[model samples]
Target chain A: MQLAIVVNEGPYTHQASDTAYHFTKAALEKGHGITRVFFYHDGVNNGTRLTVPPQDDRNLQKLWSELGEKHGLDMVVCIAAAQRRGILDADEARRHGKDASNIAAGFRISGLGQLIEAGIEADRLVVFGD
Target chain B: MAQKKKFLYLNRKAPHGTIYALESLEVVLIGAAFEQDVSLAFLDDGVFQLMAGQDTTAAGMKNFSRTFKALGDYDVRKFYVERESLAERGLTVEDLMPITYEDENEDYAEKPSIHLVGRAELAAIIADQDVVLSF
Candidate 1:
Protein backbone atom coordinates (compact mmCIF):
# COMPACT_ATOMS: atom_id res chain seq x y z
CA MET A 1 0.00 0.00 0.00
CA GLN A 2 1.13 3.55 -0.62
CA LEU A 3 1.47 5.31 2.75
CA ALA A 4 2.10 8.89 3.78
CA ILE A 5 3.80 9.68 7.09
CA VAL A 6 3.42 12.85 9.18
CA VAL A 7 5.89 13.63 11.96
CA ASN A 8 4.66 16.43 14.20
CA GLU A 9 7.26 16.71 16.96
CA GLY A 10 10.99 17.43 17.12
CA PRO A 11 13.65 14.83 17.83
CA TYR A 12 15.31 14.07 21.24
CA THR A 13 12.62 15.86 23.16
CA HIS A 14 9.99 13.54 21.68
CA GLN A 15 9.96 9.93 20.57
CA ALA A 16 7.62 10.70 17.70
CA SER A 17 10.32 11.36 15.10
CA ASP A 18 12.24 8.25 16.10
CA THR A 19 9.20 6.02 15.90
CA ALA A 20 8.23 7.52 12.57
CA TYR A 21 11.69 6.77 11.25
CA HIS A 22 11.57 3.12 12.34
CA PHE A 23 8.05 2.75 10.98
CA THR A 24 9.04 4.21 7.62
CA LYS A 25 12.11 1.99 7.48
CA ALA A 26 10.06 -1.11 8.24
CA ALA A 27 7.36 -0.16 5.75
CA LEU A 28 9.97 0.31 3.05
CA GLU A 29 11.58 -3.00 3.92
CA LYS A 30 8.23 -4.65 3.37
CA GLY A 31 8.18 -3.08 -0.14
CA HIS A 32 5.28 -0.72 0.51
CA GLY A 33 5.66 2.57 -1.32
CA ILE A 34 6.01 5.84 0.63
CA THR A 35 3.96 8.60 -0.92
CA ARG A 36 5.52 11.32 1.25
CA VAL A 37 6.91 12.14 4.68
CA PHE A 38 5.55 15.49 5.84
CA PHE A 39 7.07 17.38 8.77
CA TYR A 40 4.88 19.87 10.59
CA HIS A 41 4.76 21.73 13.93
CA ASP A 42 8.03 21.02 15.71
CA GLY A 43 8.69 18.13 13.36
CA VAL A 44 10.21 20.59 10.89
CA ASN A 45 13.17 20.74 13.28
CA ASN A 46 14.12 17.29 12.03
CA GLY A 47 15.16 18.80 8.70
CA THR A 48 17.79 21.15 10.13
CA ARG A 49 21.39 20.23 9.42
CA LEU A 50 22.64 22.18 12.45
CA THR A 51 21.81 19.51 14.99
CA VAL A 52 24.95 17.83 16.26
CA PRO A 53 24.26 15.12 18.80
CA PRO A 54 27.03 13.48 20.83
CA GLN A 55 29.00 10.88 18.90
CA ASP A 56 27.55 8.15 21.13
CA ASP A 57 23.91 9.12 20.72
CA ARG A 58 21.88 8.34 17.62
CA ASN A 59 21.75 11.19 15.10
CA LEU A 60 18.11 11.38 13.99
CA GLN A 61 18.58 14.16 11.41
CA LYS A 62 21.26 12.15 9.68
CA LEU A 63 19.11 9.03 9.95
CA TRP A 64 16.18 10.73 8.19
CA SER A 65 18.39 12.29 5.51
CA GLU A 66 20.01 8.92 4.82
CA LEU A 67 16.65 7.18 4.74
CA GLY A 68 15.25 9.69 2.29
CA GLU A 69 18.33 9.39 0.13
CA LYS A 70 18.22 5.58 0.11
CA HIS A 71 14.49 5.34 -0.61
CA GLY A 72 14.20 8.44 -2.80
CA LEU A 73 11.33 9.43 -0.53
CA ASP A 74 9.47 12.70 -0.95
CA MET A 75 10.51 14.21 2.39
CA VAL A 76 8.85 17.58 2.84
CA VAL A 77 8.98 20.09 5.68
CA CYS A 78 6.03 22.49 5.77
CA ILE A 79 7.37 25.90 4.78
CA ALA A 80 5.04 27.86 7.05
CA ALA A 81 5.94 25.78 10.08
CA ALA A 82 9.61 25.69 9.12
CA GLN A 83 9.80 29.44 8.81
CA ARG A 84 8.05 29.95 12.13
CA ARG A 85 10.59 27.67 13.81
CA GLY A 86 13.60 29.09 11.90
CA ILE A 87 14.35 26.01 9.77
CA LEU A 88 15.37 27.48 6.46
CA ASP A 89 16.57 26.29 3.07
CA ALA A 90 19.19 28.29 1.15
CA ASP A 91 16.56 30.12 -0.89
CA GLU A 92 14.40 30.83 2.16
CA ALA A 93 17.38 32.09 4.12
CA ARG A 94 18.27 34.48 1.30
CA ARG A 95 14.67 35.63 0.96
CA HIS A 96 14.39 36.26 4.69
CA GLY A 97 17.77 38.03 4.76
CA LYS A 98 19.21 35.44 7.10
CA ASP A 99 22.93 34.64 7.00
CA ALA A 100 22.64 30.85 6.83
CA SER A 101 20.36 27.97 5.83
CA ASN A 102 20.03 24.88 7.98
CA ILE A 103 17.74 22.51 6.08
CA ALA A 104 19.45 19.14 5.76
CA ALA A 105 19.76 17.04 2.62
CA GLY A 106 16.86 14.98 1.22
CA PHE A 107 14.23 17.33 2.68
CA ARG A 108 12.51 20.12 0.80
CA ILE A 109 10.33 22.98 2.07
CA SER A 110 6.79 23.18 0.67
CA GLY A 111 3.25 24.28 1.35
CA LEU A 112 0.57 22.39 3.28
CA GLY A 113 -1.01 21.42 -0.05
CA GLN A 114 1.60 18.65 -0.31
CA LEU A 115 0.17 17.15 2.88
CA ILE A 116 -3.40 17.35 1.59
CA GLU A 117 -2.25 15.83 -1.68
CA ALA A 118 -0.61 13.02 0.26
CA GLY A 119 -3.90 12.34 2.04
CA ILE A 120 -5.68 12.24 -1.31
CA GLU A 121 -3.09 10.08 -3.08
CA ALA A 122 -1.89 7.68 -0.40
CA ASP A 123 -4.00 4.70 0.64
CA ARG A 124 -3.23 5.51 4.31
CA LEU A 125 -1.89 8.56 6.13
CA VAL A 126 -0.04 7.74 9.35
CA VAL A 127 0.67 10.54 11.81
CA PHE A 128 3.31 10.46 14.56
CA GLY A 129 3.15 13.22 17.15
CA ASP A 130 2.30 14.32 20.67
CA MET B 1 -12.23 14.95 -11.51
CA ALA B 2 -10.96 12.12 -9.33
CA GLN B 3 -12.99 10.62 -6.52
CA LYS B 4 -13.36 12.87 -3.49
CA LYS B 5 -11.64 11.43 -0.43
CA LYS B 6 -13.11 11.80 3.06
CA PHE B 7 -10.68 13.85 5.18
CA LEU B 8 -10.97 14.15 8.96
CA TYR B 9 -8.98 16.75 10.94
CA LEU B 10 -8.66 15.44 14.49
CA ASN B 11 -8.13 18.06 17.21
CA ARG B 12 -7.04 16.97 20.70
CA LYS B 13 -5.48 20.12 22.14
CA ALA B 14 -6.62 23.36 23.70
CA PRO B 15 -7.01 26.58 21.70
CA HIS B 16 -4.21 28.52 23.41
CA GLY B 17 -0.84 27.64 25.01
CA THR B 18 0.04 25.66 21.86
CA ILE B 19 0.25 26.08 18.10
CA TYR B 20 -1.46 22.80 17.14
CA ALA B 21 -5.02 24.12 17.18
CA LEU B 22 -4.17 27.17 15.07
CA GLU B 23 -2.02 25.23 12.60
CA SER B 24 -4.69 22.55 12.32
CA LEU B 25 -7.24 25.16 11.34
CA GLU B 26 -4.82 26.51 8.74
CA VAL B 27 -4.62 23.07 7.15
CA VAL B 28 -8.40 22.78 7.11
CA LEU B 29 -8.73 26.07 5.22
CA ILE B 30 -6.00 25.10 2.74
CA GLY B 31 -7.33 21.58 2.34
CA ALA B 32 -10.78 22.91 1.50
CA ALA B 33 -9.44 24.02 -1.90
CA PHE B 34 -8.97 20.39 -2.86
CA GLU B 35 -12.77 19.86 -2.71
CA GLN B 36 -12.49 16.83 -0.45
CA ASP B 37 -15.23 15.74 1.95
CA VAL B 38 -13.70 17.31 5.08
CA SER B 39 -14.73 16.97 8.72
CA LEU B 40 -13.30 18.41 11.95
CA ALA B 41 -13.38 16.42 15.20
CA PHE B 42 -12.97 18.22 18.53
CA LEU B 43 -12.25 15.96 21.48
CA ASP B 44 -10.28 16.19 24.78
CA ASP B 45 -8.96 19.73 25.21
CA GLY B 46 -9.82 20.42 21.59
CA VAL B 47 -13.37 21.29 22.61
CA PHE B 48 -11.97 24.58 23.93
CA GLN B 49 -11.29 25.62 20.34
CA LEU B 50 -14.97 26.24 19.66
CA MET B 51 -15.80 27.91 22.94
CA ALA B 52 -17.68 31.16 22.39
CA GLY B 53 -16.27 34.61 23.27
CA GLN B 54 -12.62 33.64 23.20
CA ASP B 55 -10.68 36.77 24.24
CA THR B 56 -7.01 36.47 23.31
CA THR B 57 -6.28 40.07 24.29
CA ALA B 58 -4.53 39.18 27.55
CA ALA B 59 -2.82 36.19 25.97
CA GLY B 60 -1.49 38.39 23.14
CA MET B 61 -2.00 35.69 20.53
CA LYS B 62 -4.19 35.99 17.47
CA ASN B 63 -7.82 35.27 18.30
CA PHE B 64 -8.12 32.50 15.74
CA SER B 65 -11.38 31.17 17.12
CA ARG B 66 -13.07 33.52 14.69
CA THR B 67 -11.48 31.63 11.83
CA PHE B 68 -13.76 28.69 12.49
CA LYS B 69 -16.65 30.84 11.38
CA ALA B 70 -15.06 31.29 7.95
CA LEU B 71 -14.70 27.53 7.43
CA GLY B 72 -18.37 27.31 6.49
CA ASP B 73 -17.70 29.61 3.55
CA TYR B 74 -14.96 27.24 2.36
CA ASP B 75 -17.53 24.46 1.87
CA VAL B 76 -16.10 22.70 4.94
CA ARG B 77 -19.16 22.18 7.11
CA LYS B 78 -19.04 19.10 9.31
CA PHE B 79 -17.67 19.63 12.88
CA TYR B 80 -17.99 16.63 15.17
CA VAL B 81 -17.60 17.49 18.84
CA GLU B 82 -17.41 14.44 21.08
CA ARG B 83 -20.14 14.37 23.70
CA GLU B 84 -18.03 12.57 26.32
CA SER B 85 -15.15 14.98 25.87
CA LEU B 86 -17.41 17.96 26.53
CA ALA B 87 -18.97 16.36 29.59
CA GLU B 88 -15.55 15.59 30.99
CA ARG B 89 -14.55 19.23 30.54
CA GLY B 90 -17.84 20.41 32.10
CA LEU B 91 -18.92 21.97 28.82
CA THR B 92 -22.14 21.58 26.84
CA VAL B 93 -22.82 22.14 23.18
CA GLU B 94 -24.43 25.45 24.11
CA ASP B 95 -21.03 26.64 25.37
CA LEU B 96 -19.66 26.50 21.85
CA MET B 97 -19.95 29.20 19.21
CA PRO B 98 -22.94 29.10 16.87
CA ILE B 99 -21.23 28.14 13.60
CA THR B 100 -23.48 27.76 10.59
CA TYR B 101 -23.40 27.33 6.85
CA GLU B 102 -25.74 28.17 4.03
CA ASP B 103 -27.09 25.05 2.39
CA GLU B 104 -27.19 25.63 -1.36
CA ASN B 105 -29.18 22.45 -1.88
CA GLU B 106 -31.94 23.73 0.41
CA ASP B 107 -32.66 27.19 -1.00
CA TYR B 108 -29.53 28.47 0.76
CA ALA B 109 -30.96 27.77 4.17
CA GLU B 110 -28.73 28.68 7.11
CA LYS B 111 -27.88 25.49 9.03
CA PRO B 112 -25.73 24.69 12.02
CA SER B 113 -22.38 23.10 11.19
CA ILE B 114 -21.52 21.61 14.59
CA HIS B 115 -22.61 18.05 15.23
CA LEU B 116 -22.67 16.90 18.87
CA VAL B 117 -21.97 13.15 18.78
CA GLY B 118 -21.22 10.38 21.24
CA ARG B 119 -17.89 8.57 21.37
CA ALA B 120 -19.28 5.49 19.63
CA GLU B 121 -20.88 7.56 16.91
CA LEU B 122 -17.65 9.53 16.43
CA ALA B 123 -15.73 6.28 16.13
CA ALA B 124 -18.10 5.10 13.39
CA ILE B 125 -17.69 8.41 11.59
CA ILE B 126 -13.92 8.06 11.82
CA ALA B 127 -14.13 4.55 10.39
CA ASP B 128 -15.97 5.98 7.41
CA GLN B 129 -13.12 8.32 6.47
CA ASP B 130 -10.41 7.72 3.83
CA VAL B 131 -7.88 9.93 5.62
CA VAL B 132 -7.67 11.08 9.24
CA LEU B 133 -5.24 13.93 10.02
CA SER B 134 -4.65 14.33 13.74
CA PHE B 135 -3.40 17.39 15.63
Candidate 2:
Protein backbone atom coordinates (compact mmCIF):
# COMPACT_ATOMS: atom_id res chain seq x y z
CA MET A 1 0.00 0.00 0.00
CA GLN A 2 1.11 3.56 -0.66
CA LEU A 3 1.01 5.61 2.53
CA ALA A 4 1.12 9.34 3.15
CA ILE A 5 1.97 10.71 6.60
CA VAL A 6 0.91 14.08 7.99
CA VAL A 7 2.64 15.46 11.09
CA ASN A 8 0.94 18.39 12.83
CA GLU A 9 3.17 18.95 15.91
CA GLY A 10 6.81 19.92 16.31
CA PRO A 11 9.54 17.63 17.58
CA TYR A 12 10.61 17.39 21.29
CA THR A 13 7.63 19.30 22.62
CA HIS A 14 5.27 16.47 21.61
CA GLN A 15 5.45 12.72 21.13
CA ALA A 16 3.69 13.07 17.78
CA SER A 17 6.91 13.37 15.80
CA ASP A 18 8.45 10.36 17.52
CA THR A 19 5.34 8.22 16.97
CA ALA A 20 5.23 9.30 13.33
CA TYR A 21 8.89 8.47 12.86
CA HIS A 22 8.53 5.01 14.36
CA PHE A 23 5.31 4.38 12.40
CA THR A 24 7.04 5.40 9.18
CA LYS A 25 9.97 3.07 9.87
CA ALA A 26 7.66 0.20 10.75
CA ALA A 27 5.54 0.74 7.64
CA LEU A 28 8.65 0.86 5.46
CA GLU A 29 9.95 -2.33 7.04
CA LYS A 30 6.61 -3.97 6.23
CA GLY A 31 7.29 -3.00 2.58
CA HIS A 32 4.66 -0.31 2.35
CA GLY A 33 5.47 2.51 -0.07
CA ILE A 34 5.51 5.89 1.69
CA THR A 35 4.57 8.35 -1.01
CA ARG A 36 4.83 11.54 1.00
CA VAL A 37 5.27 12.93 4.54
CA PHE A 38 3.67 16.35 4.96
CA PHE A 39 4.71 18.66 7.82
CA TYR A 40 2.02 21.16 8.81
CA HIS A 41 1.50 23.66 11.65
CA ASP A 42 4.31 23.28 14.22
CA GLY A 43 5.22 20.03 12.50
CA VAL A 44 7.19 22.15 10.03
CA ASN A 45 9.76 22.58 12.80
CA ASN A 46 10.82 18.99 12.12
CA GLY A 47 12.43 20.24 8.90
CA THR A 48 14.74 22.79 10.56
CA ARG A 49 18.41 21.87 10.43
CA LEU A 50 19.23 24.15 13.39
CA THR A 51 17.98 21.77 16.08
CA VAL A 52 20.62 20.38 18.40
CA PRO A 53 19.46 17.89 21.04
CA PRO A 54 21.38 16.78 24.14
CA GLN A 55 23.96 13.99 23.89
CA ASP A 56 21.49 11.45 25.29
CA ASP A 57 18.27 12.46 23.52
CA ARG A 58 17.59 11.58 19.88
CA ASN A 59 17.45 14.33 17.29
CA LEU A 60 14.03 13.99 15.65
CA GLN A 61 14.79 16.36 12.77
CA LYS A 62 17.87 14.31 11.95
CA LEU A 63 15.91 11.08 12.28
CA TRP A 64 13.29 12.23 9.77
CA SER A 65 15.90 13.53 7.33
CA GLU A 66 17.92 10.33 7.60
CA LEU A 67 14.79 8.22 7.10
CA GLY A 68 13.95 10.22 4.00
CA GLU A 69 17.47 9.85 2.65
CA LYS A 70 17.45 6.09 3.21
CA HIS A 71 13.98 5.42 1.78
CA GLY A 72 13.93 8.17 -0.85
CA LEU A 73 10.84 9.65 0.81
CA ASP A 74 9.09 12.82 -0.22
CA MET A 75 9.16 15.02 2.90
CA VAL A 76 7.08 18.13 2.26
CA VAL A 77 6.77 21.07 4.62
CA CYS A 78 3.66 23.17 4.02
CA ILE A 79 4.85 26.60 2.86
CA ALA A 80 2.17 28.60 4.66
CA ALA A 81 2.68 26.76 7.94
CA ALA A 82 6.46 26.79 7.58
CA GLN A 83 6.55 30.52 6.99
CA ARG A 84 4.33 31.15 10.01
CA ARG A 85 6.73 29.10 12.17
CA GLY A 86 9.93 30.45 10.54
CA ILE A 87 10.93 27.19 8.82
CA LEU A 88 12.30 28.07 5.40
CA ASP A 89 14.19 26.58 2.51
CA ALA A 90 17.03 28.25 0.60
CA ASP A 91 14.88 29.71 -2.17
CA GLU A 92 12.04 30.61 0.17
CA ALA A 93 14.43 32.34 2.60
CA ARG A 94 15.95 34.30 -0.29
CA ARG A 95 12.54 35.23 -1.69
CA HIS A 96 11.21 36.28 1.72
CA GLY A 97 14.36 38.38 2.47
CA LYS A 98 15.41 36.14 5.36
CA ASP A 99 19.07 35.81 6.34
CA ALA A 100 19.35 32.03 5.98
CA SER A 101 17.40 28.83 5.38
CA ASN A 102 17.00 26.18 8.07
CA ILE A 103 15.22 23.41 6.13
CA ALA A 104 16.89 20.14 7.04
CA ALA A 105 18.08 17.81 4.29
CA GLY A 106 15.50 15.70 2.40
CA PHE A 107 12.58 18.06 3.09
CA ARG A 108 11.02 20.42 0.52
CA ILE A 109 8.67 23.32 1.18
CA SER A 110 5.48 23.28 -0.88
CA GLY A 111 1.81 24.29 -0.82
CA LEU A 112 -1.19 22.64 0.84
CA GLY A 113 -2.10 21.20 -2.54
CA GLN A 114 0.60 18.56 -2.06
CA LEU A 115 -1.27 17.25 1.02
CA ILE A 116 -4.57 17.03 -0.88
CA GLU A 117 -2.77 15.29 -3.74
CA ALA A 118 -1.28 12.77 -1.32
CA GLY A 119 -4.72 11.93 0.03
CA ILE A 120 -6.00 11.38 -3.49
CA GLU A 121 -3.05 9.33 -4.75
CA ALA A 122 -1.88 7.38 -1.71
CA ASP A 123 -3.74 4.34 -0.42
CA ARG A 124 -3.74 5.76 3.10
CA LEU A 125 -3.12 9.16 4.72
CA VAL A 126 -2.24 8.93 8.41
CA VAL A 127 -2.17 12.13 10.46
CA PHE A 128 -0.11 12.44 13.68
CA GLY A 129 -0.64 15.34 16.01
CA ASP A 130 -1.45 16.57 19.51
CA MET B 1 -6.90 8.63 -12.98
CA ALA B 2 -6.81 7.34 -9.38
CA GLN B 3 -9.79 5.89 -7.61
CA LYS B 4 -11.86 8.32 -5.57
CA LYS B 5 -11.04 7.81 -1.91
CA LYS B 6 -13.22 8.45 1.16
CA PHE B 7 -11.49 11.14 3.21
CA LEU B 8 -12.69 11.99 6.70
CA TYR B 9 -11.17 15.00 8.43
CA LEU B 10 -11.34 14.56 12.21
CA ASN B 11 -11.55 17.72 14.33
CA ARG B 12 -11.10 17.22 18.06
CA LYS B 13 -10.13 20.74 19.15
CA ALA B 14 -11.78 24.11 19.48
CA PRO B 15 -11.16 27.10 17.22
CA HIS B 16 -8.58 29.74 18.24
CA GLY B 17 -6.30 28.82 21.22
CA THR B 18 -4.31 26.77 18.67
CA ILE B 19 -3.61 26.93 14.92
CA TYR B 20 -5.05 23.45 14.17
CA ALA B 21 -8.58 24.60 13.39
CA LEU B 22 -7.50 27.22 10.83
CA GLU B 23 -4.83 25.06 9.25
CA SER B 24 -7.21 22.10 9.07
CA LEU B 25 -9.72 24.33 7.30
CA GLU B 26 -7.03 25.23 4.78
CA VAL B 27 -6.55 21.53 4.02
CA VAL B 28 -10.29 20.93 3.75
CA LEU B 29 -10.60 23.82 1.27
CA ILE B 30 -7.76 22.47 -0.85
CA GLY B 31 -9.00 18.90 -0.48
CA ALA B 32 -12.38 19.86 -1.92
CA ALA B 33 -10.70 20.73 -5.23
CA PHE B 34 -9.68 17.07 -5.54
CA GLU B 35 -13.32 15.95 -6.01
CA GLN B 36 -12.91 13.09 -3.56
CA ASP B 37 -15.59 11.95 -1.12
CA VAL B 38 -14.85 14.13 1.92
CA SER B 39 -16.57 14.42 5.29
CA LEU B 40 -15.80 16.33 8.51
CA ALA B 41 -16.37 15.10 12.07
CA PHE B 42 -16.39 17.40 15.08
CA LEU B 43 -15.68 15.67 18.37
CA ASP B 44 -14.55 16.75 21.88
CA ASP B 45 -13.91 20.52 21.86
CA GLY B 46 -14.26 20.48 18.09
CA VAL B 47 -17.97 21.20 18.36
CA PHE B 48 -17.09 24.73 19.55
CA GLN B 49 -15.92 25.47 16.02
CA LEU B 50 -19.50 25.47 14.75
CA MET B 51 -21.07 27.76 17.33
CA ALA B 52 -22.65 30.89 15.89
CA GLY B 53 -21.78 34.55 16.59
CA GLN B 54 -18.07 33.88 16.90
CA ASP B 55 -16.30 37.20 17.35
CA THR B 56 -12.51 37.03 17.29
CA THR B 57 -12.16 40.81 17.61
CA ALA B 58 -11.19 40.56 21.27
CA ALA B 59 -8.94 37.59 20.55
CA GLY B 60 -7.09 39.65 17.89
CA MET B 61 -7.38 36.78 15.43
CA LYS B 62 -8.93 36.61 12.00
CA ASN B 63 -12.53 35.53 12.32
CA PHE B 64 -12.30 32.15 10.61
CA SER B 65 -15.73 30.97 11.72
CA ARG B 66 -17.11 32.47 8.51
CA THR B 67 -14.95 30.11 6.49
CA PHE B 68 -17.12 27.21 7.61
CA LYS B 69 -19.99 28.92 5.84
CA ALA B 70 -18.08 28.92 2.54
CA LEU B 71 -17.31 25.21 2.76
CA GLY B 72 -20.64 24.38 1.15
CA ASP B 73 -19.52 26.27 -1.96
CA TYR B 74 -16.60 23.82 -2.37
CA ASP B 75 -18.93 20.80 -2.69
CA VAL B 76 -17.94 19.78 0.85
CA ARG B 77 -21.27 19.15 2.51
CA LYS B 78 -21.03 16.36 5.06
CA PHE B 79 -20.31 17.83 8.50
CA TYR B 80 -20.83 15.41 11.38
CA VAL B 81 -21.16 17.15 14.70
CA GLU B 82 -20.95 14.63 17.54
CA ARG B 83 -23.96 14.82 19.83
CA GLU B 84 -22.13 13.61 22.94
CA SER B 85 -19.48 16.30 22.58
CA LEU B 86 -22.09 19.07 22.41
CA ALA B 87 -24.17 17.66 25.26
CA GLU B 88 -21.09 17.25 27.45
CA ARG B 89 -20.19 20.85 26.79
CA GLY B 90 -23.76 21.96 27.66
CA LEU B 91 -24.57 22.99 24.11
CA THR B 92 -27.38 22.12 21.74
CA VAL B 93 -27.74 22.02 17.96
CA GLU B 94 -29.55 25.37 18.02
CA ASP B 95 -26.41 27.01 19.40
CA LEU B 96 -24.39 26.06 16.31
CA MET B 97 -24.09 28.14 13.17
CA PRO B 98 -26.83 27.44 10.64
CA ILE B 99 -24.56 26.19 7.86
CA THR B 100 -26.23 25.15 4.64
CA TYR B 101 -25.49 24.33 1.02
CA GLU B 102 -27.44 24.42 -2.19
CA ASP B 103 -28.41 20.98 -3.40
CA GLU B 104 -27.56 21.46 -7.08
CA ASN B 105 -29.26 18.22 -8.11
CA GLU B 106 -32.45 19.16 -6.34
CA ASP B 107 -33.11 22.41 -8.18
CA TYR B 108 -30.41 24.13 -6.12
CA ALA B 109 -32.44 24.04 -2.96
CA GLU B 110 -30.69 25.18 0.21
CA LYS B 111 -30.09 22.29 2.66
CA PRO B 112 -28.58 22.00 6.09
CA SER B 113 -24.97 20.80 5.97
CA ILE B 114 -24.49 19.81 9.61
CA HIS B 115 -25.37 16.26 10.59
CA LEU B 116 -25.75 15.69 14.30
CA VAL B 117 -24.86 12.11 15.28
CA GLY B 118 -24.12 10.01 18.33
CA ARG B 119 -20.74 8.50 19.15
CA ALA B 120 -21.63 5.07 17.72
CA GLU B 121 -22.78 6.51 14.41
CA LEU B 122 -19.68 8.70 14.19
CA ALA B 123 -17.55 5.61 14.81
CA ALA B 124 -19.24 3.86 11.90
CA ILE B 125 -18.57 6.86 9.67
CA ILE B 126 -14.90 6.76 10.62
CA ALA B 127 -14.74 3.04 9.91
CA ASP B 128 -16.09 3.65 6.39
CA GLN B 129 -13.40 6.15 5.50
CA ASP B 130 -10.35 5.36 3.32
CA VAL B 131 -8.27 8.00 5.08
CA VAL B 132 -8.77 9.78 8.41
CA LEU B 133 -6.93 13.06 9.10
CA SER B 134 -6.91 14.36 12.68
CA PHE B 135 -5.50 17.66 13.96
Residue-level lDDT tens digits of model 2 in A1-130: 9999999899989999999999999999999999899999899999999999998999999999999999999999999999999998889989989999999999999999899888888888888988
Candidate 1 backbone collisions, by pair: none
Interface RMSD of each: 0.6, 1.1
lDDT by residue (B77-122, candidate 1, tens digit) is: 9999999999999999999999999999999999999999999999
Q: Give me the candidate number with maximum TM-score.
A: 1
Candidate 1 chain A minimal-lDDT segment of 10 residues: A116-125
Per-prediction tally of clashes: 0, 0
lDDT of 1 at B54: 95
lDDT of 2 by residue, B5-105 (tens): 88899998999999889989999998888888999999999999999999999889988999999999998899999999999999999999999999989
Weakest lDDT window of 10 consecutive positions for candidate 2 chain B: B1-10
User: lDDT for each of the candidates?
Assistant: 0.97, 0.93
Give candidate 1 misplaced runs (Cα > 4 Å).
none
Q: TM-score of every model?
A: 0.99, 0.97
TM-score of chain B of each: 0.98, 0.98
